[model samples]
Target: MRIALLTEGVHPYAQRAGGGWCRRLVEGLAEHEFQLHLLAGDGGGSGGGGGAGEGPATYGPATYELAMWGRRPAGRGPAAHRRRAYVRAYRELVRALVLPGERGSFASGLYRLAELTRQDGALPAFLASGHAQRVLEREWRAPGADTAAGQPLVRDVLVAGDLLEQCLRPLSAPWYGPGPGRLGAVDLCHVVGGGPAALPALVAKRLHGVPFVVTEHGLHLREQYRSYRSAPYRWPVRALLLSFFRLLTEETYREAAVLTPGSAYDQQWQQRCGADPARTRVVHEGTEAVGREAAGVEPEQPVLVWAGALEPGRDADLMLHAYARVRAELPGARLLVYGEESAPGYLDHCKAIAERLELGEGVRFAGLPESTAQAWAAGTVVVFTGLTQRSPRLLADAMLSGRAVISTEVGVAREVVGPSGLLVPPRDPAALAGACLALLRDEERRARFGLAGRLRAQERFAVAPVVTAFREIYLELVSHWPAFPAVDGADGGVPRPFARPAEYWVAGAMAEAH
Candidate 1:
């Protein structure tokens, strides 16, 4: 079967953990042909010789690489009739964003704009034009509009217009056409999360009746909300942009054939965003299982390990305070932090906090470890201090390596840890320190929890189960959907199961052998 994998920002090219996961998914399902529809944030420095539709040289071939994104060139404005059509669609779209009662027009307006984009190649340039900004300003300040309260300035209109143009640029992407290599020809469209990345799948479904599935490790709407809260925009601009995102998420969730959230927490977020519970499923993020030889045997000297990107969300401050408490009692306890600082100055901020607490030699920033198993093996107890986590891949890695874990109660942490590890309230040093001390003092309990955690990780979070689940989902979607453009000819005809041979579930195992 041919699958269109839609992604944005990170995937295949990025060296980050998110990119690693996408690479794993594509490589794991080797029997099926994958048409990658990536929307790179910056369409440059890919080390490849050319631009969009060219996969990185390592992958070999344009069919596998249909990535798009770059600075759009300024062009002539739309023709007279086309300008009127643009105004109508842009007005409806902004009305849906600024007027609460007109929210239902969002889908109609969005699709209309997409159709216009397909017809007019200059849609991005048109969106950046004064005509588009005028349409947006008129709607934003119209009677009963939510954003009118802010009395938006001309500068706000320009910035908001620019943002809308960037988000809607996917409407102009070339991936939606019908034929062998387009999204219209795919047996299934698997979108890796949602937001603008979903625009192509949305367009394909609207134009060709294709069904698309969305997988969310964390709800993109939630991420947008968090981001916009700290965004340096005026009330009108922030309100307008956030409304677009929230409404877009609703559209994506409402139209998706299935929503696979990596954690139950994200499933709840989807439901709140208007996703049907009947169509939602919880599929935990998968990871390669750590081998027995690579597993930790429990470190000496009562050392505690912290893994994951060093960012504010990881709450290194809370961990330091908790460790200070642990050090006060145990005196010999040490905390070793492993991972790169994701944001500039975050490492120094953490170190400063440590100094203020006088943690001294008791704490050490060890940078990223050679391997996850090695990191887990370096400490007696693995501590997860993240205030929020969607799937916590490192926690799974630690469990697979057979280490006792103490995690702050957050998204899926309690679910992932289950009965195998300790949980504490987020931001509470007392609870975290107590849990750490308990595990550190008792080797037998630690051993029991470690064994249970390893068993749990093996049963649920292993890569094989995730790959199998998606394989079955793709088969089920294709078998039941008769309108799939790829299956039916120009003349309506009976639908058939995917033409590909039975999936080779051993692809991962074979790759490991090599």
Candidate 2:
């Protein structure tokens, strides 16, 4: 079967983003063909020498076809006709955002803009125009509009417009409508993330009767809410943008053939955001089992390892406080932080906190390790202090390495840890310290927990089973998808033979053979 894997700001080229997961899926299912429809972010720039259809060299050999679509160029300005159409369509879209009852108008306006984009190819210019700003202002100030009370300023409108332009740019891509080497030809469209990444897949399903599946590793709406809450924009601007995201998610959830959340925590978020419970499934991220030798080794010191990017979400400061308490009880205890810095200045801040606490040699930032096994081997206990997480890969690695894990109660951490590891209340350094101390003081208990963790990882989080589940989902979707009618004589009838059950094909083949 051929699959179109849709992604934004990830895959085919990105080194750290969701690229690794996409690469794994494509590589694991070698029997099927994959076409990567990548919607490049601001940093992604234009497509390389591979052009639009061929995979880039960064992704290695030609296992899958790659189509790169980038952000609209800033230089090209829209013409008078296109600008007028953009204004009308954008006005309608904003109205739908403010008034939930106008969802049909929202879909209509969205597609109208898509149509104009196809004809004029100047969506970027339209979004940059003063007319777009006027349209947003009018909608925000409209009577009964939720944002009317906030009274947005000119700067807020401009910033919001810029953000909206980026989000809606996917509609202008050539891959949306019917054509060769586009979404219309794929057997299934599997979106790797939510929000804007799933927009094209939504269009493909609506326009061509294709079945699209959404696999969300993180809840896009929750991430957006967190980001926009702290944004510099005014309340009105934030409200407008958030409303747009909420609407997008609602529509995507309603239309998707299946919603695959990486964990039950993520599944709950999806359902809360209006996803049908019948269409949702929890598919855990796959983790490769560690070698027995690596799992069996004992560390030379009583080391606590925290392995993840140094970001605000990781709450490294809380970890430091907990370690300080642990050191008071166990002076020989060491904390090994093994990961690259994700947020600017976060690593320096963590180091400063450790120094202030006089944890000189007690704490060490080991940066990136040569291997996950090596990192886990350097520590007796694995710790996670993140305030929020969605089936973190690091925790799975720690469990697979047969280490006793001490994690804050967060997204699926408790569920994943089960009885194999200890869970502490998030943001409470005292609780975190107590948990770590408990595991450190009892070597026998630690060994038992480690063994249970190793067994759990092998049984539930192993790569083979997760990959097999996805393969089955793809086959099931393809077999039941509504077939589109043939446009000409060369085109076959609607509900193509591929959509028929395997038994039908096998029976026909047997009769032919006889």
In angstroms, give how far residue 76 of model 1 lies from its true place. 4.4
Model 1: per-residue lDDT, tens digit, 107-175? Answer: 999999888877766678788888988898888878888973688899999888987887787787766
Residue 503, model 1, lDDT = 43
lDDT of each: 0.79, 0.77
What is the clash count for each candidate, in the order shown?
A: 0, 0
Q: Per-residue lDDT tens digits of candidate 2, residues 1-514?
A: 6577877664222222567678778878888777777766443323422125446554432322222334445446567756777788888898988765676687777777776776776776788777788888887777778773677788878887887887787776667444445666667888887878787787777666678899987777777887776677788888888888888898899889999998888989898888999888888877645444446677767999998889889999999999999999999999999889978999999999999999999899999999888888888999999988775577878888888998998888977888899998999999999999999999999999999998887777767777898998988877766554322323434343354456667888999999
Residue 389's lDDT within candidate 1 is 73
Name the candidate that leads on lDDT.
1
What does candidate 2 score on TM? 0.84
**What TM-score does model 1 achieve against the real structure?**
0.87
List residue ranges in candidate 1 displaced over 4 A. Answer: 10-18, 44-54, 57-70, 73-76, 289-293, 309-312, 339-357, 486-514
